[model samples]
Target: MKLDVNALGTFYRMAREGAGLAAGRLTHMTEVETQVGVTKLNFMRGREIRRDFEDATEKVAVRVKLTGAIEGYSMVVFERENALRVVETLLADSDSETDIDVDAGEFDEMTQSAVTEVGHIMNSGFIDGWADVLETVIDVSTPEFVEGVTAEPFFGEVDETPDEDDLALLFQSSIETVGTEIGFSHYLFPKRESMAALLDRLRTSGGIEYDKLDGFDRMAERGAEEVAKTATTLTGIDTSVEIRRLNFVSLEAIPEQVADETLVGVAFEFDGMPSGYLLFLFDEESAHEIVDAMVPMEVDEDGFGEMGTSAIKELGNIMASGFLDGWANVLDTTIDHSTPEFIHDMGAAAVDPVIIQLGENQEFAFVFDTVVMADGREFDCEVYAIPDENDLERALNNLDVDRIEETPTTAEFQELENS
Candidate 1:
């Protein structure tokens, strides 16, 4: 069972199309405007996945077992409040004289029934989209409802508590109702062999070994961890990686997904076997906080003026080295990055140059999507690492999967002279 960029791109498109259909169905049923949000494939360890679901906020998920073309589980998860809001809309359309208090924690038979219907329709739309792409039929089972403040309800259904090394293939699709502002997560989990067969059928190029996927996961995990460590060491803020995902998307879709308002960003172009651009973006407030944390004394600067910009660029330079070093160690190759390029403008404007440079060569990119944040502080940073398609394919092909696990991730930190 091997995988390639083309196969993964097809999977991404299939999921996106399904998400749109699901949104359409929701609009028709609830009579509320709806839309599909970010759709990406997530490769996470069992430990990371468990940590993600334990946010202390109650959640409701509709789980269905799949057989036929796809074999595994499909889950639709919603926050407790969002589920209540959606149920309210479904109940409003019914000819019932009774009004249930959703906030009172009373989900009776009728509410459960409505949620089930929503879950069923959503699953069908998603599976139908995939079927249309693969030209196969997938059978879905009865929907089962699970709700809890902890991860027990969901984890209990799974075979067992998976260890950290166990990798899970999770496809995430978010759907939001415009009027109610309700958001829900849809996940598709297919069996290993089934996924391998699907990939084999969809793959166009000579796919890399399936085991090589492990190298991709390790590099991303190590890079994200190093960036967080570098940020904390430089700014003295205890920052940590929140979410890290490998996304394949079009160059045109890149700018559209970024924040619309002005952002403080640090951009870099790295030259290596898989040469490409890397960017670290932060909100205006977060940038200010980092500047303040680095410079003890408050300067009388309006926006990020000379002193502030310098601080950001220096941080970016060191962080860039650390990030690339992680990859260099993984691939057993040297990756040199250019000097940090400071960007203070709208988010779309920051990425326009990179898009233009890469747009001529390829349509899609393998983007490392990561978020680093600190608890109880404004230290949020979004990291995007886009690699060249041909070069990346070449690098991945040369990767020695056996050595990745034993190789240590070390950041080459250099001292910056203060002017």
Candidate 2:
């Protein structure tokens, strides 16, 4: 989104006034240099935004390309003084320290006042007007919005767009991809007997409950569906979906970043989809046990195998495809998806923001804990959704498992018959 010019000016003005008040106390430095430096910084910040957002390298030319005329308003005297005090406090400990002996209480009060003033400025009608303009720009840039909403309804009215039917197909495709690529055959809907068995084993060994597993499974299915829908709308891909469960414990002993504790993930996927995979991962230890069980590797391995990265990527690809596909089906459109990316050792850190950005302008989050077990090892799983909790819940409730008939047991049975 483009920065609000008026808002930007207001921020700079407030900052400058604050600097000036603080500069009043400085006897050692030249006022001209400080003021010039502040102005330069403001100009540079604007230029930086333009360069990043608009790719305009001619800094001087871009600076003069104002969207609207600048207002001729003088700085508020009280606000200027407060701004100065704040600037003084910030630069107090700098190597090029100012000679201002600021009163701590007075500085705090003035700074608070200055902040309040800026807040008010942001909430003013001018900012609201700018926000409306920005929202329109964003909607125009996104093709789905343009196609889904008529220009009049899109620009003049905001209404809920009904869900489409293809969304479920996209989700199913993502699930199939993830299941095949990551060896997470248990991740698909209807809770395959093998997956149920795995869950039961984890619960029996780790004392986790069936309800928790059911909840996790439900959430994973829902996440896959929502992701599919989002991907379809955002990227025009109808087969990108992701299933994630967080804060899960691995049931088997394995390698860890620390000595023992870590997180686990389980994912699924589908076919004929863009970015063609759905994936989930667990803590290092949990992954190790899973890998051991899935492949013919010995159980004493210290680290994930060379196939681990590919496995993770395949999983991500499937999930992304599922979500995109689901979204496309719902929107009656198509979307393209990119190859999946995976990062292991993301322990206890803040969730990635890019994932959340997929659902633009919609406030969405996922909050749930699940467990993972393999070969008698246990781990915790936490889940996060792209938009809001309700969306995730709705997607899960609407998931259609019958759309994809291939399950681990059925596949195995087919293999036996073929043999």
Task: Please list the C-alpha lDDT of all candidates, in the order they appear.
Answer: 0.77, 0.29
lDDT of 2: 0.29
Query: Per-residue lDDT of 1-419 in model 2, one digit per residue for the tens?
Result: 11122323333333334334323333122222222112111111112222222332111100000111211111111122333443443344443534444454343544443333322221222222322433421011101111111223211232211112100000000001111210000000111232233234323122322222233343345444554444234323233332322221111101121223344443332222111223344566545543543444444434544565554344445545554554445323355654544555454322333333323532222322211222234321222322232333333334354422221111000000000
List the pairs of residues colliding in candidate 1: none
After superposing candidate 1 on the true structure, give the runs of residues whose Cα lies further than 4 Å from its correct spot. Answer: 44-57, 93-98, 148-169, 293-302, 375-377, 407-419
TM-score against truth, every candidate: 0.86, 0.26
Best prediction by lDDT: 1
Error of 1 at 122 (Å): 0.3
